[model samples]
Target: MVLATPVYCKYYSKSVPYEPVRLQKTNLRFYLHDILSGPNPTAVPIVRPNQFGALVAIDDPLTEGPEITSKKIGNARGMYILASQGTDLTLVLYVDLGFTTGEFNGSSLSVLSRNPILENPREMAVVGGRGRFRQASGFITVKTQYLNTTTGDAVLEYNVEVVHP
Candidate 1:
């Protein structure tokens, strides 16, 4: 499946915040095709642990993009994860230029720890019987960093697709 525009978040210090920072906007492109044949291809059908959420698998080939500036600042590290508002399970499919190497050379794709899943709010009640059905949503987040700087724009591209049983 094709991915949409990524959501960007900036990190700045209140004491000495960086100003006039413009992140170079880069588009990550890729697709995840279902593996129909393989030793355990069918067994790994992109399972979503949360019944109310969805499962997204990002292809490793497309993880290159821009890098966040000011990574030295506290919490300057940026991350991308999947999140959901309802009972649907949210799965982080792919992440752009947030790796150690800081390039989308197809290296950090196996880094699943960086991505996390978000669950629905339990305090709220379900409406329209939709409560029983939980789905998963695919999303990405870019946290505190200089995406666009004088050096250049670090653009990472990757692909993620949803699979359901």
Candidate 2:
């Protein structure tokens, strides 16, 4: 006698925020400290040759503190491409961040950008958004500060401007 095996599968529909708030095109800046590795990491480090990806936690004061465990406003995921020779190498990035407490809690903003990687300061389009940032469209500025080359770690300063209503 043999026993039969059971298989289960599930699917979820596209997610959309409920009664999302709206805002006008405004400029916001923040510093993201990406730790390639540490004792405990809020965001894991991932890197590849053709493509590299990382989940970086937002740092509040531009300095390393206890933000990794608590007080983390939001997180960012960045993907990049390495070109043999070209003017455009950096692909794009998505930033999701907002207030951590009070009525503004849980109401986050998302920004989609497409900018060059090598450029010291470049502009990228803000494609989409969610939560309090619905119907968003604008641009973002990126600046890279190399911290550690061996571990492939660095700090990215982003200046976001968007309009939503």
Candidate 3:
């Protein structure tokens, strides 16, 4: 009188309704200007009371091209914290990139990942998003296009690939 054989499969379809959705891939390339030392720095350090770690908040500009003079597109707004306990310039970053022009206007994508600053090209995961990029999942690769350690300014080239419905 025992007929229990994997109850999960029996009700799996009932509990989770299947809906047909079409996902599209979007590729975007932009540049971020991280100015850490200038008078109008885009990235600033947060002095914590405990002062045990390092954290920098950023509202950096996103441009259509790698150069600073390129047409402004949007902003990469978020924060990056020191991830490594040692001398490795690694960072845990969280950012929301919002577009201001073109077809992607009003849409945004979010990313949370570890950034190895010393690496030539760093890869990061795009967790989620809103607007046109709802339920987004993808990755972004960044390369330091230009950097001035003296002024603490950097221009990073970002290539993003995202899939969304």
Best candidate, lDDT: 3
Candidate 2 structure quality by residue, lDDT tens digits, 89-153: 55555555554544335555565655566788878777666666666678778677655667655
lDDT of 2: 0.56
**Every candidate's CA RMSD:** 21.3, 7.3, 8.1
Candidate with the larger TM-score of 2 and 3: 3
**lDDT tens string, model 3, 1-165?**
888776455434446778979999999889999998857899998854343357889999999888778999999999988877676778899999988888889989999999988898989999999899999999999999988868668999999999999
Regions more than 4 Å wrong, model 1? 1-14, 40-103, 106-165
- Rank list by TM-score: 3, 2, 1
Cα lDDT over the full model 1: 0.28
TM-score of 2: 0.57
Q: How many clashes in each structure?
A: 29, 3, 0
Q: How far is candidate 3 from the true structure (C-alpha RMSD, Å)?
A: 8.1
Candidate structures ordered by lDDT, highest first: 3, 2, 1
* 1 against 2, candidate with superior lDDT: 2
TM-score of each: 0.25, 0.57, 0.85
Superposition error at 123 for model 3 (Å): 0.3
Span of ten consecutive residues with least summed lDDT in model 2: 58-67
